[model samples]
Target: MATTDDSFNGLTEYCEDCDLETLHEVSVQIRTESTKEENAQFSREPYRVCECQRCGNRSSQRMNNA
Candidate 1:
């Protein structure tokens, strides 16, 4: 059997902008649902997000389902 790490891998500080406890901009893929109801939901896609380690500032870009 394969391990969890083999399936899902995370890039730690992959971006040069991200420093130790500092504000930085990075891109990440996220899975999301379209609606609360399963029937109404559509599909999942990758999203770009920005995060700050020091101030804990996090934001996400608008979903583009196309």
Candidate 2:
């Protein structure tokens, strides 16, 4: 299983330590932005966290919704 949230599954990403593309288990985290303004709107930023299945290396990337 790639993730429990079903964001990214069965994907291969670049591993710097492995020096090649390898299969990774991916998980997503949505970070909410907060402002000091009482009426300020909030936005969510999604980040994908990847862990190499072979080498146990972890990496994260920000996702662009636009």
Which candidate gets the maximum TM-score versus the true structure? Answer: 2
Worst 10 residues of 1 by lDDT: 1-10
Which stretches of candidate 1 lie above 4 Å from their native place?
Answer: 1-22, 34-42, 63-65
Q: Pairing residues by index, what is the TM-score of model 2? A: 0.55
- Local distance difference test, each candidate: 0.50, 0.72
Per-residue lDDT of candidate 2, residues 1-66 (tens digit): 332433355577678899877778879988665565653356667888888888999877779766
lDDT of each residue in 1-66, candidate 1, tens digit only: 111222223222323344343434557676655666674335566787766544556666656757
TM-score of each: 0.41, 0.55
Clashes (candidate 1): 0
Question: Per-residue lDDT for 24 in model 1?
Answer: 42
Among these predictions, the greatest lDDT belongs to 2
